[model samples]
Structures are given as structure tokens and as C-alpha cells.
Target: MRSSMTIVHAPQSDIKMIPSPILTQVESFQHWKNDIIRDIARYRAWLRDNVIYDQRVDKELQLIQARLRDKTLSIAFVGEFSRGKSELINALLFPQSEQRLLPSTLGRTTMCPTELIYEQCSEPYLKLLPIETRQEALPLKHLKQQEDRWLHIPLDINDSKELQNTLSHIGDTKKITVEEAELLGFDCQFLESSSDAHVYVPTWRHALINIDHPLLRQGIRILDTPGLNALGCEPDLTFNLLPDCQAIVFLLNVDSGVTATDMQIWRDHIGQLQDRSATNLFAILNKIDLLWDDFADDEEIKQSVKKMKTLTAQQLNLEESAIFTLSAKQGLHARIKGDEDLLKKSNIAQFETLMFESLIDKKEQSLRKNAIEKTIFLLGNTKATLQAQLKQLEADNRSVIAMLNQGHGEMKSIAQQAKRDQVVYQNQIIALKASKQAIAKQVNTLLLSVNQDHFSTYLETTRTNFKESWSSIGIRESIAHFFTCLESDFTHLEIETNTTIKIVWSIYDKVLANSKLTHNANDDNHPDNTDSNIDKNIDRNIDRNIDRNIGNTIDSNIDNDINNNWDSHSSEQEHDLDLVQPTEFRIFEFNHSLAGLKTKATQYQKSFRSLLSGQRKSTHHFFNSVAAEAQQIHQAAHVEAKAWADGLLIPLIQHATSRKLLLDQKVKVFKALAETNKSQRQKQQELVQFQASIQLQFEDINLMIQSVSQKRPQQSFYESLKLKSTPISSEPQVY
Candidate 1:
């Protein structure tokens, strides 16, 4: 029938360079983030040394630093079983190893979704949650925090074979009754034996692989998912994990092509990602070595592979350029033997380079927006403060020189003017503090609009309604009404929050205008007299002004696309799609979290097999999970709202305090010159030295700001690969 392929083995060599382009980019991004953190630390120290430290700003920097340290780049591999998903991960992560790093073999190797990550606090181990925990009324996220609930197995990193053997337990299964399977959310149709009374189910619901791999240590997380059945059974996979992943690698077998099950998986899970700009999608036609025919020449094999890739791209509705063909098994073997020619033939390197290049581009842009842009904006404010101080100093210096020329008469007038400005500054400080209190009260009122107690009441009312009528329609309608109320609550909260933000902004702006008027009135030499026209009508109707300026107000926009409803029953593909747009809002995050819960509820409602009397346990479990998730969301939203309210006046207060300090210094300087016996020449020399000192400080801060904003140049590995476009023949080619 077919000629055997020969294996040419060479001495295995260690991977000298970073194994993957994604790893390279992650390393660069991590280093750049560290550098920025170091710069921020230095800037904070400098501020403290200069006696200009703002506690509020320092807290914000601390929060940013924490986020940078905790940030992770996650990639998910999705496909049916036997698609070489696990094999591809092994080839990518442990190329030099003689055996597979993960359990990648024939049949369903990964029965549960496995996440490979690194946590420095924990030793190398495998943490697995029992499948029975599915009956728990808490979300997986909540369950993860309960360490005792997971079965921990320590991993021996020194032995790759031992590690692989241990991970193979992810596919461990147990025979359970069909009733139990259905109760645990398993589709019995996928069971090994439909005629049997019992079915095989995954022993573990989820897997966490924590290791000290270089890539994982640098915050690169790999999510190895199960087949289509698992995707449908686990709501977290569809609603939470899939949506959160930045890149999804959808694998398909070249020989099998795209089957109905594959299309279903794509439409329900991976297809929607095509609309997400933040997420990079790649359809991989794996196991290409299966198509390597002994009867065919090299050109014919290439043509076959190219045709498969093109068809896969069309099937997935992705560009051909985004579809890659490779043989993970061959790639792993090639790497282990250090056979360069075999590795090239495997096409793994080419696929990795292109896929990671696209992923890295998106990742870098996100980092730039969240870290670089926000840091620059904050530093810009500090720079503005320094410049303002310099200007005030120069103005004070000029007044001193004026006193030296004009004599005692002008000095007395200047002293009187400084005292009047001091009184005005004190009044403005009290007014700003009052405004801060007012906003705090308003934010407290706004938080009450989303209170946990209120949500619990609504949930209880729905449960009561459902219990009154024991039909499926009653429960479904009750759930729908609950969600409708929930959505209405957030809609009302959004409106109230916007109003509060505008009111808070108006009060701060008015106080700032008053403070500026005082400073400008005193500093005759000050440049930019823009504050003179800053709506001197603060006593006018504030509500009318807020309404007029609502459009200009910073609306807390959200990522509406992150939580699109997954309609599994609807076969029609949704052509109208929205990308994940950039926006900042804690409420939106909370809102999206609710969207996932709503999706879970919808799935649960559809899964109802009987009336409430017949399926009381299932119905109760569903409602309990929803209620728990709702309570958690409420608590989290409360915390965010409280923090927001606390920080609302921080920037304004910091600015006002800095300006007040400068004003006080000016008043003291004027008094000292007016009442002192110091000679004119000495005063002039002191002024000159002060001006030089301010200039030096300004230059140092400017350099620090630049260092924080400087971009790190990362070389693109995809370009280095020089991959050619797929060659299509004039005539049709088929395998």
C-alpha cells in the first residue's frame, strides 16, 4: 500500500533562543513593564524627597504597579479531541524534551480544561477540582479561592516523564449512572456506551498546572481545553474563559476537514472571536503528516496542504493568511532529535511565528494603552505642577526685585496684598473640602442604588414567584423577569452615576476656578491668563450648566462586546458584530460579569428536564448559583464605588494644596523682604540661586517622564521567518 517514512535522528541540542515568538514578546513586554515600575518608584521617591508627595497619587501608582506585576498573557487552544491540541502545546513549550511534557496521546487525553500557569508563591504541582463540585452553588472562580477543596499533587520538575505521567491523570474518568451524568451537566450522547446504565465522566472538573517554566514564569498562560462536549457542558468555558482569552488557537485535523461538530464549536465559541479586535484568531489544520502520501511527490503534498488550509480558512470565515497547517507530532519528534530538515518540514516554526506575531501586536497595543498611556497622563500632571511652582517662584522673585527698586512704600503694599490672598486661599480650601464631602454623600447614595440587600430581595421575590407556579414556563419567566430587573437596575445606576460624575466635576471645576483667580490676581507676571474667563458665574444655576455640558463630560464607556449572549439554539450566524473597544468603567466590568451569569442562567433554564416538583434539586442548584454570583457582584461593585468615591476629590485636593503651599511661600517671601534687614544685593543673589535650583529640578523630572514614556523596540520574529504565501495551482487540487 504505502512506503514507510524514514527517521533521521541527530544529537538533541538545547534550544538556544526563546522557543516561541510569543515568549520573546512577553519577555520584552515584562522587562519594559519592570522598567516603567522602577521609574515610577524613583519618581515617587523624588517627590517625597522634594516635600511634594501626594498620598493619593502615590496610591494610584501603587495600584498600577500591582496590576503590572499580576498581569498575565493567556492563550487558549480550542478544538475537538484528537486534533493535536495538546501535542502542539508540548511542541511549543518543551521542544527539546524526549517525551511529551503534557499528556498528549491517542484518543481523549485532556478530559477537562487545563490551565498551565506559574505562581511564584506555590511549588510545582497539579491542582485539580473534583467533578462533584459541579453540584456546589458557587462559581468556579469562588471555588478556586478555597484551596482545601482542590486535590493537590506535587510535581517533580526534574523528571519530565514523571510530570507527564502525573498530568495524564487529567483524562482520568469514573463510571457514573446516567442520572448522575445528567445532574452533573454531561451530555449522555457523548458517553462511551449509550446502551449501558452507567457512563464515563471526567474525574476532575478543571485542572491547574503550576510550574516554573520560563515562559509561564514570565506570565504566559496556556489553556488546553477539551472537546465540544466539554465546551457545552461547562458554562464557564463558554461564558468566562473563552471570552477572556486574548488569543484562541482553533485546531482542526487536516484529514477530517471541518465536520458538523467542528462547525458547531466554531459558531458557538471560536467564530464570535473573529469580531473581537483584542483577540487574535488562528485556525490550525494540524496532523498534516497524515496527508504525506508515499505515492505523491513533494509538490503534490504541498498543494494538498495548501488546499486544506484554504478550505479551512473559508469554512472558518477567516483569511487564508490566518490559517496555518502543521504536524505537531512530527514537530515534536523533529525537535527531540534536533533534525533541522524534519523540523522545517513539520511547519511548526512558521505557524508559530505568524500566529504569535499577530498575537504580540495586539498584546503590545493593549499594554501601551493601559500602562504607557495612563502613566504618561499621570506624570504629565506632575510636570504641570512643577511648572506651576516654577512660574510662581519667578513671580515672587520679580516682586522681591521690585521691592529692592521701589523701596519701603511698595513693600508695605505688597505685604497687604499677600495677606488678602492668604485669606482667599483659606476660604477656597474650606469650600473645596465641603464640595468633597458633598460628592462623598452623593456617591454613597449612588451605591445604594446597587445594594446587595436590594438585589437579594429581588432574587427572593423571583424565587417565590417560581415556587408559586411549579411549571417550567413559570421558572423560565421568573428568571427572565429577574434579569430584566437586574438590567433595569444597572441602567438606572448608569444614569445616576453619570449625573454624579458631572456634579462632582462641576464642583471641582468651580473650586479650581476660584483658586486660580486668587493666584492669578496676585501673580501679575504669570503667563496664560486663561483662568480669567473660566465661567465667573459659579453662583448661577449649576444644574443647568451641568445639563449643558453633559456631552463634554467623561462618560464611563464600557466594553459592550465582551459579554454578547451565546445563542446555542440559533443556527443563524450574527453578522452584526462589535469589537472590544477601549473604555474605562468599573461598573461596566461589573455589568459584564452579570452578563456571564445571565448566560449561565439561560443555559440552565434550557436544560430543565421536568417541572419544579420533579427537578427540585436541579432548580434549587441553578437558582442558588445565580443568587451567589449576584451577591458577589454586588459586594465587588460596592467596593469599587466606595474606592471611587474616596478618590473622587484626590486630584483636585492635591492640586489645590500644592497651589496653596506656593501661595503661602510667596506671602512669607514678601513679608521677609518687607520687614527684614537683609541687604538688596544678598536678596538678589538668593533669588538667582533659587531660580537655578528650580530649573535643575524641572530638568530632572522631565527626564524621568521621558524615560517612563520611551518605547522599547522589539524585533518581529515573523518577518525573520520570511514565510511565503500559499501556492495555489491553476487547476483544482484535492487530497
Candidate 2:
């Protein structure tokens, strides 16, 4: 039976606050982040006085802003037992702490996974869950709420080793006689049926360490996962925790290379990156110091490492650039001692530089990109509105200047031209109106094809097919088959969307052709009465993919790990005498499998729906865009035609009237019209100035972004770690 645990809100009294390395330097990443925050603020201001947006646009902008406010980077490090996973973490983030943050030994010490975190301004502490809770199979998120279920251990940050000592228990496990293990819920059915057999069980199922390290203090939380066994037992680790991590590093031993066990981990965990970004996943060839050849010089060492990197890349079916090699032990030692030569030998500094360049820098780029895209889009709309406002001002201003100078004789000709222009505009409006009606009819027809019922029917068809194959094919085959179903449904949505886009453009072209501006009936000198109109504006579908491949790039980085989770504790435990008890293991396995099956259908439904939702949003957004494109052209034409007629005729009429009127009446009316035009010109000038200033800011932001993006590895760090030898084959050299 499990016992109740006590919980206390971690107090912030007397905590050692480490200043972040990032804050100490004004790096490119920090600079970009600050710029983005300022841009977002300016964006909000612009939106306030200018553009009107809907709920969806508002929600998206808010989310990007929230990411700015809460700048946390979470990374997960996963590997099998004895891969020096702990040492690599210690090397990367904990070298300055001067004490080992977690336990690492030649033996399998890290029994369960641990998440190292530091809530800003909170005192350092530890939360441990006892092994007894494994029976309940409750997720850690729920168990965390009970507070009492955890063993809270507060730390004395003043003592350097205090944290190290407390965290040593992460590696702690207890061995029990087979019979005793069976009594405590381990399965011992096939363990030689021996009374003397012993089984090892982790004393704690999970540990949460709250420590104030420099990186952690700066909003970076690292998840140090356990060996393959814990990944088997912990469902929450595979599902809830790992999926949320911004980046995941898979560590492998250089001596063993991609072993059978490593391959399994790759196929299950790392392979899931097909749905997520391949960029977010990294494979490290660790313990490279073990491969140092006695006779090998600098060149030879380079060749060997390069070959190994290439081979590793081939085995994993990843890009060679994605595979990096380093010796964690040497790296930690070098970092602690500040030995540059040893650091080169360890290849740690190069890896660190690349991480700073690739991961951390890319993270900043991603945030800025989100801000820039939305800002750019909204600003584009604001600029168009300002231009529209200005066009009206320009038309009115020109009319006043012309009216003041027009001769009485010219009035008759100008009036006759205005009348003819009005007729021409009327004809164009009729054509435009007819075109708009056709578009509305087509849009309605297209929208009918995308109703909720239609989508639901497609999903139901997929689910029905999934249900039929699920029992016969088992998990792997069933999953592959389900993706096929999704592909089919996705294709249906894509095809329908593509057809709609074609129909919309076809209607646009046909209607816009009907708008034949008659220059002969009106003023032939009108600026818009030329081939430029048709060539420029009528090509409505230029470069715009209506559904944009129906989010082809969107589906490339999917989150498909929801249901395809494979437990890592192999059935190799079935006969191993030195591991988990067999009889109880069988029961645990059955229970976990049964539980997984119950949730499988639900998880699959959620996953497919999420993918479908992305494509659906793309379709709708595309629909709106096409509609807006067509509308803008019609609106621009209407406004221009009116402005031309009003601009040309109003001034001539005013001049004719001024001649007839007495000086007093003419002066008052002339003054009022002149003041209105002057006021509008001032505002229009301000809008132009504002646009220029914002454009400069936008240019600076883009230049800075590109500088970081094009940031090539300088010869110093990159050359030190460059791989000289290439693998034998271009193809995946299966090991």
C-alpha cells in the first residue's frame, strides 16, 4: 500500500542566485530578442489605430507575444544505460557549478529519469516519488498535484556538494530476492524458478530537482532521462513530457556505435522526429576519446572521426551534419580546468560553439520569425489602407489646383469629359458587380464541400477502416495503414481546395476582362487606360498556391508519438536472472499493455485530427486570401475611377463658378475647400513618414536576422572539430 506524502511550497529564503551567462554578454541572440519585443509593442500600437482583426488573428498574435514574455527553452537528453548521458549534461551546463550535479558511475546508476528545473526566484529543492506508486500507474502530472505523494528535500545552496549528495539518490536502486520482488508486484514466473535469484528495482520512480544553475536560472530546463528500462515503465515520460520538449538529444557510445539496443531506441524515439522537426533532434557520438589511435596524428584523428560520423549518419538515415562526436569525460575535465588543448581533444568546445550557433541561435530566430511574419503581414495591410487614404487626398488636392487655374472656355470640355467618364465607371461597376456575384456563388459552393459534416464523414470513414485493420495487423502495421488513410483524406481535402482556387481565379479573370475602360468616350489621356492594368492586376493567382500545397511542409513536422509509443524494457527480461522478477514483470507488462490499448484509439483520433486541423486552417486562410485579393482589385478600380472623374471635373466646375461669383462668396468657399485639402495632405505626409521609419526598423531587424542565419562556423571552433574522412557509400550503409 502507498502512503500519503507531505508537501510544502518551496520557499525562496536564502537561495544562491547565479547570474545568467546570457545576461552578462550582449550577444546577437539577446539583441534580436529585445528587438522583437519592441516590434511587438509597436505592432500592437499600429493595430490599435489601424487594422481591424478577427479572433483567430488576435489569438495567434497573443500567443507569439506570450512566448516573448515566457522565454523558456526546454531540452531533453535521452540514451541507453552507460552512455555518459549525465556527464554530457554536466559538461554542457553544469561545468561552472564546480560540483557534479548528478551521479555517474561505471555501473548503471541513473535508475529513473529526472527533470532539472529552477522556477525563477524559488529556493532550490528536490521532489522524489517512491517505487510503491508504480502500481497505481497514475501520471506524474496528477501525482504532483497531491503534493503529499512526493518526498520534498529542501537544499542548502550555500554548500556546493549538498545538491550533488541529494541527487545521488537518482541512481539509487534496491535488490531483492525473486520471491520478495514477486510479492512486491514484480513478475518472477521464468527466472530459473530459483529461490536465490535477485531482482533490482529503482528505489524511486521519478525525481524532480529544483536547482539554481546559470542556464536553468535563465529559463532553460534540462530533462536527463534514464536507461531504456525506465522509458519502458514511465508512460508519462514518453507521452506527456518528451513531446513538449523544444529539443531532444540522443547520445550513443562511440565504442559500440549504433548497437542493436541503440537501433531500437532510434526506431522508436528518435524516429518520431519525422513528425516533429528533424532540426530539433540531434544524435551525439559520445565517448570519442575511447577511439583515440596511438599511431594516429592530427590528420588521422580527423579522418577516423569523419568516417565514424558518416557511418553513424548512414545508420541513423540522417544527414551527416546532424551527427556530432565528443568525449564527455574529457569535455567535463577540460571545462573544469580551462584547458584549451584538452578541450580540443574532447571536441566539447566545438560542439558547444555549434550548439550556441545552431540550437540557441535558431531558437531566437524561431521566436523572431513568429513576430516578424505577423508584424509584416499586419503592417502590409496598414500600408495599403494608408495608400488608399492618400489616393483620395491626392485626387482632391489636384482638383483644387486645377480648378484655381482652369479657363471658363475649358469648363464645357471638362464637364463633357466628366459625364462620359461617369458612364464608363458605371459600366465597369456593373461588370465588377456581376463578377463579384459569380465569385460569391463559387465560394459558397466551395464552402459547402468543406462543411463539418463532410469532414466528419471522412474521419469516420478513416476510423472505420482503422478499426477493421487494428485487430488483425497489431500496432506497427496498423499505424502505417492509418497514415495511409490520413493521406487519402488529406488528398481529398487538398484536391477540393485546389479546384476551388482554380475556379476563383477563372471567375476573377473572366470578370476583370469585362471591365474594358473606354478611353475614347472619356479622356484618352487618363493614366490607367492602358495594357499595364490588365498585365499587372488581372494576374490574380500569381505565385500564390491557393491551399499552399495544403500544408505539405506543415505535415512534414508532425507529432505522431501519441499512440506509437513502444515500451523499452525488452522481453529480454523474460529469462534474465539478474533483472526485474519475471512473474510480476508479466503482470506489469499485461497491465501496461491493456492500459495502452484502452488509450490507443483516443490518442490516434487526437493525432490525426490535429494534422487534419492544420490543413483545414490552411484551406480557410487561403480562401480568405483569394477572396481579399479579388476584392482589393475591384475596390482599387472603383476608387481610382471615382477619383479621376471627381479630380478632373470638380476643379473645372469650381473655376467656372468662381468667375460667376462675387469676390466675397468665392473667397469663403475657396478658403474652406483649400483648408480641407491642406489638413488631409498633412495627415497623409505623417503616414508616409511613419511608413518610412517602420520600414527602416524592419530592414534592420531582417539584416540582423540574416547575419545570425548566415553565421558560418568560423575557422577557429569549426576547423578544430572538422571531420576529414567520409563514409564509404552515399547510400544508407546498414550496419
Q: Of the candidates shown, which would achieve the greatest lDDT relative to the real structure? A: 1
Instruction: Encode model 2's per-residue lDDT on 185-287: one tens digit a residue.
Output: 3333322233446666667878888988766766667888876544432435544566557677889987677888687666645554434431366678888
How many pairs of residues collide in each model?
A: 0, 15
Clashing pairs in 1: none
Report the lDDT tens digits of candidate 1 across residue range 609-654: 5323335545656676566666777777776666666666655555
TM-score of each: 0.78, 0.57
Tell me each candidate's RMSD, in Å, in order: 10.4, 18.5
lDDT agreement with native, every candidate:
0.67, 0.49
Candidate 1 regions with alpha-carbon error over 4 angstroms: 1-22, 95-99, 159-164, 194-197, 229-232, 271-278, 293-307, 317-321, 353-373, 395-424, 461-472, 512-637, 664-682, 717-735
